[model samples]
Target: MTFNIHQDYSEDTGIRHSKYSETSGEDFYHDKLNEIFYGCYTRNEVLELVLDGGDDGYTPSFLDESIGNLVYDFTLDVVKTMLHIVSDWEPYWIDEIEKKTYPKWEERRRKGEQATITKSHGAWYRLINGVPEKRVWIVYTEEQ
Candidate 1:
């Protein structure tokens, strides 16, 4: 059975986020995948759910990050092959990645002060000292 992540994206479940549910869009996306990874839905169903989210339509950010992490178990070639099936839905060109990488936490990584932002594999993570050793958020960087 497929799960409807957003029964109503417009309605706030009181999850509390900087802008919306504290669970960044990417993390929420992962939660859905967990269902797939565990056999709740086949990979194809996962792709279908992604292809159909929101008014602007789900952005690549929503799928790319989660899909990239899939390499932890599935191969880069396998993920690419899956993406190829729904090529039209992707916003950008996603080619084969030689290595699959997950966002990691950095310390004193901001403005010379260490601003670290990384994405985590699952929902809810622990912070190491104040910076998460795991990726939970996406970080924007300035030139060195």
Candidate 2:
């Protein structure tokens, strides 16, 4: 049986993300997964999923024995895009990173910050600690 993964794309960050859901309420065999795809998020989580037999999230004995085959349609562009969006969506643990980053923008940052802003083609921008600095971060759902 072929596995179908779900895809989600966000324009603000210009990245796509994917998640796989069981269709028949039954665990899929490793060999049954024929076409796996990834959006712009990091591959580490996905890689772990592919090798779930030994990963903490999935039981090793069940995966190693019952799992069949696994394949992936990895897309660098999608990964890049997802990272772009995620970086803008969440910066850090601090309450207001942008306000703290740039003192000059403190006044403006205090006024509800925008989740993301577009700078140009292939370029996404976000503020941190009130500073006007550019940064990129990768996001994985498993991490959350």
Which pairs clash in the backbone of model 1?
Answer: 108-114, 109-114, 109-115, 110-114, 110-115, 118-135, 118-136, 119-135, 120-135
Name the TM-score of candidate 1. Answer: 0.37
For candidate 2, write residues 3-101 as lDDT tens digits: 211111111111211122322111232122211222112233332122212112322222221211110111222222221211222234112322332
Off by over 4 Å in 2: 1-26, 30-32, 37-57, 66-144
Candidate 1 per-residue C-alpha lDDT over 24-130 given as tens digits, one digit per residue, 9 for 90 to 100? 44454345553354342242433333233334434334444444444333433333334332234443323322221222111112212322224334432223342
Candidate 2 matches the true fold with a TM-score of: 0.16
The prediction achieving the highest TM-score against the true structure is 1
lDDT against the true structure, per candidate, is: 0.35, 0.23
RMSD of each: 10.0, 19.1
Question: Where does candidate 2 have its weakest 10-residue lDDT segment?
Answer: 9-18
lDDT of 1 at 94: 36
